[model samples]
Target: MRRCPGGRSWRRAAWRLRCFRFVKIDCYSIETNIQIFAVCASVARRCGYPNRPDRGGGPMNFSARGLSAMFSVLRQRNFAIYTSGSTVSLIGTWMQRVTVGWLCWELTGSGAWLGLLAFADMFPSVIVGPLAGAAADRWDRLRIARISQMLGLLQATFLFVALVAGFLTIELLFAVVLFHGVVEAFNQPSRLALIHSLVGRERLGAAVAINSIAFNLARFVGPAIAGVLIATVGVAWAFALNAMTFGAFALALAAVSLVRDDALAPRSGFLREIVDGFAYSVRHPGIGPILMLMIAAGVGGRAVVELLPGFAADVFGAGPIGLAALTSSVAVGAILGGFVVGVRQSYTGLTRTVIVSVFGIALAVAAFTVTDTLYLGAAALAVAGFFMVTTGVGSQTLVQLAVDGSMRGRVLSLHGLIFRGGPALGALLMGVSSEFAGLRLPVAVGAAILAICAFFALTRVNAIADALENEPRN
Candidate 1:
């Protein structure tokens, strides 16, 4: 076999993979072949699979190696268990979300009610996130996550019961959604901080990326499952299914053990700690700036995603199919982007990647605004989604790696608050603006805002990298 530029090691792996698969290697582009080879080799080393010289060893399994690398963080036994349960729970969560939205529309037949429902689901983070963060730091993170998930299961069960018993109303539905929103507000920070204990600092980035991949995967799968259930059995079954998943996750949480727990010393007042988390994040050179960048993209660039339905109806004239196409495109891009970032072994160039992704998202959205064709618009939105996940996951991974252990929950809560709430605020503003100025221009202006923020971030990349990457662990 002729040697490739990547050297003999990867080539040998590729040759072995090619022989095992029994397909023509030339069917895939050389570049694609190289990537497959690289991922196979890297996963082999990481997962303790054999990739030594072409001795009389057995044939290599490229697919197994690729999957191992994609889920490399699962090597942490606790995380693997946690992830197994959470994956089931997340799919159910999405099912419930879709069912609830459909039920709301059926009852009210008002777009205004749908907007209000979305606001209720998202706005609690603004009020509850800081306090929740403080609680995560003060109490046991695993305990908090388990309790919140249990509450989620109960919420789903109640919704199902109410719907079956003929006592459900719009007011009750609204109230229940708001209650669950508060539960999730508490859940987000604790669950995120808990990953550190389960996986340790070395695998934190991979864990975060894997979490995102699972989320996007469920985003696609859940709606399809919900649609089938809602159409055939009943809308109530979606909630029932969600309740089961939540129970599974809660049980899984009970089964896992933490590898490294952050000792929560008795701190000052709870309110003081919340304030201190904010103060520390604001004062830190690296976190402070990247956070500001995230907010800009969240409000401006990310907000556009929430308005895609309007774009489909008004700009593309494709209706539900157009909306589904655009939505699926985004999900595909996000999953692919998460997979790409998940394989990294270091944070060496991640800061720059984060900054560049901000620009990529902005430009992609800007391109989307100008396109009148549905296919082109979907393509552009896919690019936006790719950059959107990269920016989110990248910023989050950096924050997780840089934050002091004591402040992990509090700082991450701030990150979670902006991640969940910023786009809601932006969507409200941009949605209203679209009513007066039209949809395209408001989205275009939001992209412009994001581009400007990226330009500012470009100037500070080196400083942010040094502060985030070089900081000593607590």
Candidate 2:
């Protein structure tokens, strides 16, 4: 088999090249398509030879060398810098998130206030997501992201100062959080859509996978660090630390230059662009089902992570430590799943992966729902997290692969809504369900729903794969 010209892993970039053929691939071929694209292709380039092998007919290379090749996306100069900075910043962001919730409880001591604060932060996704996505298409994504991070820094600074000076009230907290959410509505789409420019589309899947690993690693470490800071110095330090992290990310963003392709998708009316984006996604067979499965993950029992405190104290009798352990377990599993996704070579396997992992999440959640032992429940949660990452990250890769450059921002913004917003919706349902039936019943019911949805979504994905394989090239 011929190797791609660049030293990059042809396997990693291969999907962006050859997978549209929808030809079958094996573990060996899947294993060795090491270069995501021998070199990242310019997104604006018209259809030509895949910059690398999207599919390779190479003989098996099953040595331990293949393991190292999994993270080949890091070889890109800009992506490595971005990953380093994001990992640091995300840790702080996670820490602040934990601190904010604790601060809210400390100030108000009411679950309802906690719920309201969460609502303030997440509700913007529904209202402003599409508008932000439209702006992503019209303006420079790097500028939007950098500006958003700067605002986030300001929000953190204001909160830190206000808390230290005793200037914060519960109402002030809500307002501060609401401001952060609004910034995020603009930032999230730009950030998600910008990855294509960083490493190029060939390595997009690996880039997304490695990103999840960084995020989950931060997720595991950040809150634990925040917990210590809260116990040792005070919660205000967490906010201050978070503000500093925002500066780090802004600098990182400044260091990386994003390639702009204005001609790729000519600008249209903002509202019309939003309308066109929605129409494009809905008409695509793959995007619809992939998003639905993601929604299911959001609404499914995997989201029980939000309700872990109840399980930790009420059911397991292990209290806060058990809660920490449960969440940490999930993060650990997710990090591993990120490795699986980052290295994977074939989109052919993704349809099956999405379906199987969703079912795996259902079973894992069901087991957790019924388990009384603290350790046992934590184990179940880990399994659920592993499958959840597999499903979410796999769906994300598929979604990115499915859309054109014009629709990338809007489509991914919708995905961001489902990925982030779905859990908020699920949390509300679970809270209400707990009031009516009990903890176990709502989760049990959700797990069953997820399984049913996975099977249904599978039918749509098969059609999607077929359509993509058959799409005529320009």
Candidate 3:
């Protein structure tokens, strides 16, 4: 028999890949030829032949400068490292989320079940968020984060094992997801509060935008991968991959050294502190109104994201691939929005933008619900996603800029609660209503509610800008 060009099969393949040569082609089978081509393509990529050497002209230079401006927050070493690890972890999180949603659909095929799953994954925040925020304020934020990540790893591992062993019933999944929601409730505030410490007040907007960019980037990639895994191998492996990502993030959290000291001593009981957080967020002029706007958007607009499987499987009849494409399209638009927010040095016109995005998302989602075409629906969802990111990042940065240092953790926890919980509440309501009225009609009504909220919010835009954009006196 004629062997490959080198000694052993793997060695010969490696040698051929390294040398970029194919000799005596008749000696190789078609399978071997395909393998060799794949290896050569990988080698080509590693050798940096993406663009022609002469292509580094003015347009290329301009593009590079723009990207540099967009990612300027990465100049801070700690923020860069943290962002990298979090991006990896968030990708796995999204993968697991998509897998679970698909698995639920496979098992029950009920929109109500899917909505319940999302609720279990998010509603624990309503119960635990305030206390967790208090803990974040009183304890070491990094330590809390590291522990939460380790717990996340544990949860992902358990999920993998259970799914593989065929023991993961819907009830069990609900319990496990609810536990994860509680862990996230604790983790969110600590992690968010760390942003100020990592990059300081000056770069806070860019850092928040960069963080959102990382999240949506993961959102873009993870579901596509999960869909492929589910179509080919299964859901168990997706959970396995997610577990590894959690471990990676834990290691990253361990590696970072903080530039700012955010350590605080406990001055009161946990309940007292929790109550104070609620009152403070309620009373703050800019923070209060902005958060109310987020609540409305989260319930009316963001819940549609959690209900996407129904849209893909039932509405579009395009199945898992359609689901991935739809989710990725949203992420693409959010990434674009993040870039828009990231490059801005000032908060000028941002509050108004936030209000506009509320209206924008309402219109986009309404358009999306009315569309029967999958491609048109994806386009509409992308517009909604752009507005979603704009609203989320703008409101978050404003809150961060306007809040007192001591109250950061609690205030941010309230933000997290609304971010997660509002959707949970809306999903459950819309999901149940969909069973009676159909998915499209319920979603349209929710969008109308969002638009109404945005109209009222428009009147307070100037006051919000004055309170949020100006430096806090305290």
Candidate 4:
């Protein structure tokens, strides 16, 4: 007779008693019979049920159909709020940019000051970006973003009031621009950091691409609208509308539900955190190269945006409409570039894509410099925009994918600095060059530099492609 374990033996006895009622059994064999019944019951139970594995292991259950369904559920309302708000706000912002550039041209009639003003407005990001990045990592990003928007609103209102009171001077405008630049320095880092929270990690790339799409779309529309508005309603209305647009974004931000995660590292002393962030970024091979590429692009290529007014006034001989068209053309190309990225499912070989884009942008800028016709110049600008967006978005995706959750905010802040600050430096250089060599020369020089950089980047494409190919699986 087989002896059953203590708990199983009792259950076996009960089963045997039930069986005995239907068929006769010897007393000596009762224990053996009971043990057999218990073994059979246990085997049946084991075969009928199995334990589930933990979440991390095993094949993921998501199919293409399931993933599509999931994305459809999560993206609808949140995307609308983010995309629409940014669209409205960015249009107003671009309009103000065009109007301000035109106003600067009107005041000094010097291309150098135009560059200086653009530099003043963007340079602060470089100076303050490290600190801002640290703050973004430590602080509540949504709150910081909201605060920055409010400050921008205040600046726009101040500009509008000053313009209306007949107290507006070039110096005052420059001062206002500097103040706005400071706010933007802080705002941009926070905004970039906050994006991850709006959508989860799986959807981050798509979200970034979509955001770029919205921004470029606004870029396409805003300058054109601003051109018409500035010509018809005056610059004051542009400022007024800009102020109102900021308010709308603020409202939209207030309406969104942000889930805060407390897993990030605690805030440290400002200088200490900045040092840590810098060290971490420099040590990261992937992030380091991407950052360098961004800086090069910013300094070498992005200065063209600042030169639009000069191009319109001196080269094209068309007024606000020409300026608007030039700006919009770039934006149109960018929008198309972003759309292409958004539609693509894989990010494989993105480095090659970026290198191609840089080369294409340089070639377009060079062509624009030589082209005298407004239509031809606009077409060149459009092509430049397409390449610019492709390069910008591709680099952005690479950086975001390389960093860890803890380093996202600080690293992204550095990204914003390079992105915004590089352009400021370029504008300064171009502005100085324009003063001595004429508008076309500075653009031509920038285009040549971009071409050189693109060539160098392409040379390293295989190494970059290999690195991306071996990126850590999320």
Candidate 5:
């Protein structure tokens, strides 16, 4: 009952949560009442829980109002159905993903392997994503997504049953990861393309933004859940839960119908289209450098994400929960980054944001690397993750602002590849480096390199913004 203005949100939440832990033993006692009261007041006073104080000094429930405001595009029936379903599905996907990292670390205890697992999981998107984007023009986007998710479900089942059977191996893990990566390679493009079918051009931005928000939200929530489940139920059930959630996404996809325009489809051959896409990405001054910057940041800053499981087990000496906190810190930072961008809503400033965020990531990574304690490491990671998202979203926004309408598909596909594949390669290199030099050295080096590249890229700020100013759109 003491006022503590200096108490940070995390500290407040931590204490209130500890108090709540004793509530089950004395559900109706004064202590329990106090615990509940503490959590509610802290959440309202400190955490942004969509509640506001009334004129009469009482809090009003504004959670629904907040949700509606953030996701106004969900007013469309199909968009709502897909976003809701996909959000659930993505949470499970993240859980399985976190479990995979934990399981890999448990089996191998190698930072190299942690990086390898990340490479196995995400590298496919880099390799096959552009082809998939071209293919999505020919195939039904919804159908492709449904099929890809089914394949993902199958991959999850294998991991679940294998882990449960006590026959899982490192080789088997890589194989499953590679196959699932292939599935995601196709799924990413189809899903992105599917948005056009669900929402008109007028609201496409909101739909796209909401979809992205859901994915990042899962990035935070899923790892937290995985940590709990891995601590309690083991990793097998994590896979099983992930497999089950795919059904929700499948059903949602099946329920929606969209009319495809054959005329809008690609007329060029796949090979030439691929060549043309490559040309467009490089020929432009703005798109080319942004893509290049993405690659640098992806490898140097973003790929540090894959190293988190190693941090949890080796550095933090905690299990799934620690890993969750580590990974979720990044996601939390990323979510905050999204809010920062949304709130600022300035186009001219975004180019600088891209550079600033890249610098921020480097600083966070440096802090994380040198820290002697887990709390400091997690805090640093959260800060780094925030920069990661800002750099990512900022670069993408710049690309869109500067891209040609005729080259939209190829440019965006390249964006996907640069961000996804670059990180995969970065993880592979960093993972190997971590094995030799240890986690701190390789990570610190990468962050330092990224800082240099980000600063160097600042030389092109005017060109990038000017390109955006004169961009041609379809």
Candidate 6:
């Protein structure tokens, strides 16, 4: 009995030793696997996929897949709401735009005043965008957006009332548009900066593309609807519908449940922030070039939008429907361009894409200037649309990708300034040229300028591409 007990004790001890070794080996394997994963994940995250989750315990639970999934969710909800609201609102906005242009033409019959109104409406964006961006960084963007929407609704209502009462003159129209533009100066930056909060940085490019899709989709629908509405209902109903449409967006804004970060720096003096923001933008290599490109494009390329009214009336002689078709063609191309960028995983080749697209835009603009046929004009506009969206979306993606979290709002404000201000300057110059020279002169001149800018961009493509390459990965 003693021998049996001793043998059993020895067997138990040996079994326990083997089990201990096995457990240690298993634990080591798991640890090794996790370390390997972290290294692989870190690499991917640095390559613009910042959402990868680490092993064990960590606060930042990021994964490329997870980021993509989150974007899918946000896209479904935000895109649906924004797209629907914008579709309705943009139709009304476009109608008002066409009517305003027509009214201006009827009242003064000069492209200069038309350009003046356009400049008046858009110029505030340049002046007010930085302040607004500071506010967006400091305040609750959602609330700011809501308030701006309400203000816009009120502005639209006043315009509608004026039109209905027969008190709508060109001056009143210009004043109302200017008021609306001021509101937009605040609204656009907040709305754009707010997008990062909704979807996070990982999917920002996709979010931007989706947003462009919404705007362009509206572009597609708005002009066609505006054309029909103006032909059928007269211009007063168009203004009223614009008011109602803004009201719907306000309601939608009220309904969305956004998750915002509270990490933003406290609000400071407006001028200080604006100056600081501008200084930072000038210093940053990546953002500086992008802003410069936007300025060039806006001034030289995007002014085409301002001339569409004249093109439809003077060049095509097809009236409102023709104008609508021209606008929609551009939108259609833009929508396609947005889709192309939205699907790409990185902005690696964006510099080349932008340069090519800019050249394309120049070619299209030159082509459109010579063409008198509506179909040919539409075709040119469509090509122009494609190039425009590619340039815009590509620049946005590059800027967003290059910026850090702290400076996003400020940098984007500069972006807003270029986007809004560039066109204003362009329109003013073009309008003046058209008045002094002819419509063809502005178009031809703008195209040549765009071509030169594109060439400049191409020459620096290597530097831009290097900057993108050198960006710190997540």
Using lDDT as the measure, the top candidate is 3
Off by over 4 Å in 2: 1-63, 106-112, 259-264, 317-320, 435-438, 468-474
Candidate 4 per-residue lDDT, tens place, 254-275, comes to 8776654325656678888888
- lDDT digits (tens) for residues 260-353 of candidate 5: 3222455688777767777878988778877888888888888888888887777777555667766776676666655444333235455666
Q: After superposition, how far is residue 2 of candidate 6 from its true place, in Å?
A: 99
Backbone clashes, each candidate: 0, 15, 0, 0, 1, 7
- Give candidate 6 misplaced runs (Cα > 4 Å): 1-83, 266-268, 472-474
Weakest 10 consecutive residues, lDDT, candidate 2? 36-45
RMSD of each: 13.3, 14.8, 10.6, 27.0, 9.8, 23.4
Q: Estimate each model's TM-score.
A: 0.81, 0.81, 0.86, 0.83, 0.83, 0.82
Write down the lDDT of every candidate, Cα atoms only: 0.76, 0.70, 0.81, 0.74, 0.70, 0.71
lDDT of 2 by residue, 1-474 (tens): 112335568764673354332222212222221211111112101111112223211122223564566567787778888888889889988887767766775675544455456556665776788888888777888899889889999999999899888789999998998888778877888888888778776777778988899988887777667755664467788899999999999999899886534234576678898888888877887787677777887888555776665565567764334445566667766766676566665555565566667877888899889889765675677667767887788778777776787778888888887776776677667756676576678878889999898878666655866654334211
Tens digits of per-residue lDDT for model 3, 36-131:
334333422332212222211001112567668657879888888899899999999999888888888888888898899899888788888888
- What ranges in model 1 sit over 4 Å off? 1-70, 104-112, 164-171, 231-234, 309-324, 371-373
The segments of candidate 3 whose C-alpha lies over 4 angstroms from its true place after superposition are 1-66, 263-266
**Residue lDDT tens for model 6, 24-126:** 5334433443343343334223423222222101122234663464348355575457546656666666666766776677678787887888887788988
Error of 3 at 67 (Å): 4.0
**Candidate 1, run of 10 with poorest lDDT:** 49-58
